[model samples]
Target chain A: MSPKTLYDKIWDAHVVHEDTDGTCLLYIDRHLVHEVTSPQAFEGLRMAGRKVRAPEKTIAVPDHNVPTTAGRENPDNMTEDSRIQVAALDKNAKEFGIHYYPVTDVRQGIVHIVGPEQGWTLPGMTVVCGDSHTATHGAFGALAHGIGTSEVEHVLATQTLIQKKSKNMKVEITGKLLPGVTAKDIVLRIIAETGTAGGTGYVIEYCGEAIRDLSMEGRMTICNMAIEGGARAGLIAPDETTFEYVKGRPHAPKGAQWEAALNWWKTLYSDDDAHFDKVLTIEGESIEPTVTWGTSPEDALPISALVPAPEDFKGGKVDAVRRSLDYMGLTPGQKLSDIEVDTVFIGSCTNGRIEDLRAAAAVLKGKKVKDGMRAMVVPGSGLVRAQAEEEGLADIFKEAGFEWRLAGCSMCLAMNPDQLAENERCASTSNRNFEGRQGYKGRTHLVSPAMAAAAAITGKLTDVREMM
Target chain B: MDKFEKLTGIAAPLPLVNIDTDMIIPKQFLKTIKRSGLGVNLFDEMRYDRQGNEIEDFVLNKPQYRETEILVAGDNFGCGSSREHAPWALKDFGIKAVISTSFADIFFNNCFKNGILPIVLPQEAVDTLMKDAEKGSNARMVVDLEEQTVTTSDGESFSFEVDPFKKHCLLNGLDDIGLSLEKVSSIDSYEEKASQARPWV
Candidate 1:
């Protein structure tokens, strides 16, 4: 067992009780729901004759299925397939008495992004959502993770969840990150080294020089994919970066309470003698801009690497590799740089933050997108969109052949009208590379925002280093 | 239904990885917030043909595994998008326990709230269970939810542990809000003190 880190301290504080079986019943401080998963849970409550257990603690938003196009006359005019889905979420949230920030809400955005911007996500809270990106909230020094629909129902009715304690894993990234290597690159490098399932059965606490140097948005991006590497959640100790990010948010504490909150947050770090079940260290400068070439996040490679051949895998893993290759329509031993893309999407809870937009805009500056490639840039939040426009980044995107759209989850899962045609390949900034994750039979290559922008200009999988 | 005294039955074998929520229940079915009707459409894409007929080759359609109550799955068993429908469909389809080498954090937590026990076992333990599940459809396993132990038909027993707090709540069927309400009196007292000290609200 490790000495209490901030994560352990928070866990102990929130623990209602422990069972003989070692499972803990945790009280969720905040519950964020979206259209996709909340409806069924609400239905389960209705079936059991139960009202929402604590409506005030729960906030709902329509993100995954919301359209990114600025304004549409009606739901019917929204030609995207996910429009109907968003409307359904709208109706369901209303009937359940949950506070739903609809698309019309100036605050509307991806659920993970919306939670933090609205000050609904706070430090020392246990937050859960029906989206894996729920881990994004953990950057604020909270114990946040994603949940499923059945659990959603349970929380709706009970406002608590049963969970087993996870082993502690500390991944210390030392040294300064090299230029052109962002937090996305660092996480991708970790995934590449550890494989996707490396952090399973553990909550990973990131520390050391490189991690502490990242901005709050950058830390959020790192924590967001704790799930991608099979970790329960990823977190960073709250510091000046965290405090500065939360300073003037709508729900953040004010005045004396604010000072008290900062004092408490500053205490959120691992003790010097704290031990972890596992510890892995990596040099930040060694990481490069990365992209996924296979069907899983782990099947990623540096932009300069060739597509892996089936023979590259050991033993029975070759079959899965072959299957992924077949689904992706990539030839064995092909140069990854030669892979052409038809669409470029630079938004999602994963990379919709203002910093992500700016990173992409920086690469798009003075470069025109390929003649036939379709590109769209959706901001993560209204504030992010407004800030980008104020900074003149939106105009750069528009001039570079990218559609500057309203803040929403756009082309992340093809839940909205934005989708790839059958067999089309896209450079997407969203997490996940499962077959048809963007649409029916649509192939996707997961990349960073800069990589997505670089690919948009080159119309292929080009190394972002060249543009940077 | 009788207090869910003990969880017992065969654990089905599913070797697939990264089984996402969308695959468990498609996006089209998300229109209604209701959870009851989703079980039938669970794994619709894999279970059905292009014409919507049940695919004979699908794992669930296999005769021997039809009545399985426990699912022994592969690594990252619940990955990709987070749709709670995955667990709902699994529960409604009669799965009570999911034993795997690993599980996505969200899906793992979701299992407990729905009365589904998601067990994380070492690869060796999972391999043994997978073989046991593959032997026959009627293979029986006993899971004492109270004891936190899983026993196979051959009398092999594995002692597992859950958080004591969650155990009490599950045993009493209490949730977070319920637990908080249990302490309402104390909260009210604190509120009264703060109000008196401030005299403003």
Candidate 2:
């Protein structure tokens, strides 16, 4: 028999029982809910006369539809739609007796960011949220991933989820990362190599020299995009770096319990000679500043690579290629570097960490955004915002003509009032560049935070290497 | 109450991959957290043309697929950000089940809460279902919630299994909150005793 991977071990430990249909009733350790997906579940509960089973284990936060700029003072600043949504979330959380971090609470931001900042994210835990970016918590060595609304309700009621075990995939990146290369670049390169659906049905364990050297923030940026590559979750085994980050946090265990927890987390790594369903390796040196040229994250290339021609997709996918180009208003064979952007957005759970802001600020030092270019920088969380301000990064952004705003999922998926006008192009640090992702008919070019800052300064898709 | 043991209806075909939440319900409509009243605007951008008129070429616009209760979608049916509204919109559009080779993790789970069954069949199973659904409006398919089986008008039957716990919850219309409330009496009793004993509250 082959040695089991860490995913298999963790999954086995959580399995309650296998149902007749082959799906296992796995116990969930933590449940995170948001306003956008919780209302219907709450309504379902009401109609059925149900009460939240373990309200203490469930946490709710309003992020997706809240206006990033509006604090508690001007609730009216939130659009009528978002305001209603936020209010509904608040009502449901209160009625159900679930702990809610409302927007009025200074700790509120994106659910993914809130989970870790509140010390709710811990190793060896099974965390589920209604948002796909729930995989962001996997950075803590937890078995975290997103689920559906029904599952959300199920977990809320039973503190458990029905799931099938996923296969294991190991993605190893070796070699020292060159300067100016960030985890965003690493994930983009991974997606570019593996296509969008490469890791389907697999839990990806990122390993090797490059991953071991990454800070918790960098590891988070890598794991945040696991869904983009079709992975259920991406994880890094706990190490000294992980311990240092979690020690003395608000919710982390203290003293002897903390030592015991650290011992268990240290053993969460894949066993020697562990077997994986699939394995892929990439060299860190081969990676360069990356960006998405087409609609999908997989439709990406290094800054040096030219935009693909329609004919390049010689197979039946020519239609897809043509459709993406037409939607993006890009001509075939045009260099991706030559594309001009009307706006620059730096936010979203994917790249809204303090480190992301610092990277952008470093690129924007003494450089101003071009006139007429709309640039907005929203931090991922209040904690991150405070740290950025303490370091004077917010001033650098404000001086550079970028609107430094409060924390929320701003300009990412255009859920709130912050949206792009029709047909406007934006260079964004957020994930996903699907048609009208920022707004209806809006074109988004996905890039790293530093790259977004460079584009804001130049008013085009200029190379960050050149600016550096 | 009439038990909804099975659902049978015309199938709508959406062949696109990665039909994200934004396309299902544009962010503009996300203002209201309420799950109801979103079905009409479901697929608004695709259902209408640039002039805001209903597009004749769109699948939902066709009279045949207007009452479609089942959706036969392509691979990667739900990709991109996790928004529960995607499933809510699909349920509101009367799609009770979606048959696809694959689905995004979040969207697949969301289907169950809205009374939508997301079936993840193999590629071969999906191709067969797609062909049956595309045979026009009269191609009625039956999805037996009780048996976890899908039978087409052509006399073909495929059995898919769901967790008995989930099936039980769906059948009785019980949700997480409902299950917890079943023990409310015990909880109240325990709380009464604890408060009397401690008197801290």
Candidate 3:
């Protein structure tokens, strides 16, 4: 057999057929659907008069556009528009024989977080969602990517997608990471180096010492924002770290089946002489706790650096930088560390896991959020919320004057009522700082969860590494 | 999907990079499954003031652009979030074509599926269109899909590329579901074999 990358191995395994025109019917192991992107897909199915080809392989959950008010009494209280969308999902799933977790269901949460926590994501499988952060599932060694609603419709009807094969790119980080630097910082650094569209037609595989050393949660944080760097998907080959995380979860194989699955997973990695279309290497030791000062994820810099001037950017990118500065109300040639934030959010699919909460708690223990600053921590899922409570991570956040709320995307997207006020600047631990993403006129500066916690205490874009 | 053969309409200029889906239709309006009735909410936040009053400064809210059926936007148009609502909203707002230097992969595909022609031109071509769009209702650019060209109202012309398969799909209003159903027997056989091999899944 020819030496192949892990992506090629998995992708080839699932390709049903490839046409002469380069169209493929790629089998999907898991199809995760959400409220925002699935309604029209279901409508497409209804219009086509077809049924889901494999209802057993599909899992439906409503996360986006769901209210996160903690202990909401009735579905009636949800905004009329949101209520319509959520109810439509419930109606669609029941009609199509797909399992749905409504807000009332305990398993209901963000699809990306819930998929891994429940073990629906396994090694060497292809997963997809209507949501872009579906790349988060790739951490488990699955080939996953976001699809447009039309593709969502195609997947629902056929249990397979007409996909184009993406090029393979290898990004190796060779040195050890500093203490306060995290997967969030490393991923932001990768994007800053690659520019937003550098990965346009590629599927990136993160490898070498730094990526291999990360825990499963850390790897997920990196994969979740692979789309932010314009990659179709990002992957990390499943090692023992990946196996250990998936071993005992609800949907993981058990008994003798587990042994067989592990044996297959062991062979799922790329061979020693695997080929790649492109390769990039980064020295990890020098990376600082990074943060974004501009709109795009690629607009990131080390926390130790000053805000960049338009001249610092070259060619077509300078206009983007100047526009970002204008929208963010930031001045070039200014220090990023001195920028004050009125809000700090410490959760998202990017860094709202148990380990992320622990890291934040480690920094915020016995400290307090700055006066007149509003800070909050919304866990990604109910399970993460429960684990945080069991470990008293919630109490630490509350004690530090941060509002500890229920699990949801929360201020990460402002889908619910949790949003930034007009012109409010937020130090956020989520992906994407696009203008008005948090809310109308809201400004976001992306950082790690620990950096967000530190900023909450200092009321500025403080470097978590300096405090450590 | 609506048939998209050719169009010549006034183009509105929205020169901002990363014009994400959230800003296109917004999460607030994503509730309804119906693609219609979204034109009122297109660029809801930018077109309307906080009090829900129209912001006269917004191009779409201006009287001259009220009937715009073409859009000339900035680079990386329709980036962020894989909501088809972005294209749906634009289509509902009577936009038949969107011209930009580049587009995000998902949004670019979504546009073709939803009967909106997303044209990718160079920065200079987009600049010329932006200037022409600034001329308001008088500037009507012709987008001839058959000829693979976009001609300015003053007869300046630029050619663009489109994937041949997608171009075929758009020309005939072909949907992927109808196309995939062609392999139903092959799909069923594969599923049976797959189930036998991986029953635990």
Candidate 4:
């Protein structure tokens, strides 16, 4: 057989059936569900009179709409819509015989983080969820991507999804990263290099010296925003780091089974002669702590840069730049680091892990959040929150005037009480910086956790290196 | 699902790049379990002011474009989030088709599943249709899936490519789950083999 990429090897292994037109029925090894997207899917299943094909392989959690406040036990305090959605998930999970993590469950948190923490998202598996950030699981070498509600219902009924193979694109990051630079910066830089739609029809496999050196958490941060760069999925080959991360979690294979899985996972890399449709290389040492200055993730620039003028862009982009500047209330030549923020949010599927919390805590140590600026730290999952408390990271945040909250997708998308008022500017550690993503008329500037911490201290988009 | 062989309707022109899903239907509207009733909130922020009044200048709010069944939008339409609510809102608003230079992969797929045909044309063709669509309610555009062509009111025509399988499914208004059930035996055998090979999963 010809040489195969890591994606090819995984895709071939999961094919249940194929058509002459290159369409394949890919078997899904794991399905992660959340409240917001699963309600309609469960309704669709009921309307069709179907049963969940593999309930054991499916897991449900309510993250997007649950309030991150301390008093979340009483559903009455939640907005009517939020209350209904969470209740619907509770009903659906029980009816479908799916494993569910309720708001009170310590295991409950963002589905993306919870899946990996539980060892349910393993290497070489085809994982899927209804949220676009499902690409977060690809860090484990799983062929994971987001699916629509229709696909969600279909998967519930048939453990299979219809898919066409995407062209393979190789993104190589060479050299060592700068001290303050992080996985989030590398990904933001990648999106800035490849415009928003550059990876539209391909799956990017990130590889090279820098990529190999990242922890599984860091790799996940890079893959989490593959959707922002317009790729449905991004992948990294499974190595020792991947195996070590998966070793003793609840769902991981034990003893002999673990040894067998490890042996197979060792072979999950791309062959030397594997063909790639496109290749892009970035010098890791060149990346700085990056942040988005516009509504799109592609509007990222180094913290040392200035707000770009519309004239700095050309053709159709000029109008977009102008619109973004107007919406962000930014002047053309303003320094990025000088812009003040009304809020600082430090958590999400993107940077809610223990490593991210530690990064932020290190920056906040012995420092206080700027006066009058509201800041909060929401861990990615309940377990992550517990670990942070055990590590005493939570106390550091609280002492610094940051509200350390329970785990969920707090202000990332703001379906809960953690929302921005109209025109409130926030420096966040979430994925998308799209208009109104954090709240109504909320302005979001995406950054890494440490950068968010720096912003909290300075009340602006500050460079972490400066704080260091 | 509904069969979409052809559609001839008033087209609304929205030429903004990166029209993200959050713009199509905001997160606040996603709490519902039903797919219907979202049309009222389609482009909710752009369509209405903070006080809940319609922004008259927004194309869809204009009288001529009120009943638009097709959209001539900018590149990378539906560019963020896999809400699937984006397509649901568009379909609920009675948008039968959309023409663009490019589309994000997940949005393009969701469009088909929701009976919305997202047509990809060259920049020139889109420019022509965009200008033609600006002519208001009297101007009409036709999309024929069988013929694989989009014709403007002025008789200009352009052909577009679509996957044969997706085209077939759209033509028949097929239920994907029902179709997959046809091969249950194959799925069972594959699962059995996979389990034997890797029982830990």
* Residue range B1-201, candidate 2, lDDT tens digits: 112457889987776766766778776766654666878888888887667899898888898888988988877777776677787788777778888877776676667666677777777777788889887698899888788888888978888867576577666665544454454464455445633432211
| Candidate 3: clashing residue pairs, number | 0
Superior candidate under lDDT, 1 versus 2: 2
- Write down the TM-score for model 1: 0.87
Residue clash pairs of candidate 3: none
lDDT of 3 by residue, A278-329 (tens): 8989998978899999988889999989999989866556887888898899
- Candidate 3 vs candidate 4: the lDDT winner is 4
Kept native contacts, fraction for each prediction:
0.42, 0.42, 0.57, 0.72
Best by DockQ: 4
* Evaluation by lDDT, superior candidate among 2 and 3: 3
Report how far residue A11 has shifted in candidate 3, in Å.
Answer: 1.7
Off by over 4 Å in 2: A18-22, A70-72, A314-316, B1-8, B120-135, B138-201
By lDDT, rank the candidates, best first.
4, 3, 2, 1
TM-score of each: 0.87, 0.90, 0.96, 0.99
Worst 10 residues of 3 chain A by lDDT: A64-73
User: Candidate 4: where are CA atoms >4 Å away?
Assistant: none
Best model per lDDT: 4
Which candidate leads the pack in TM-score?
4
| B-chain TM-score of model 4 | 0.98
DockQ of 3: 0.58
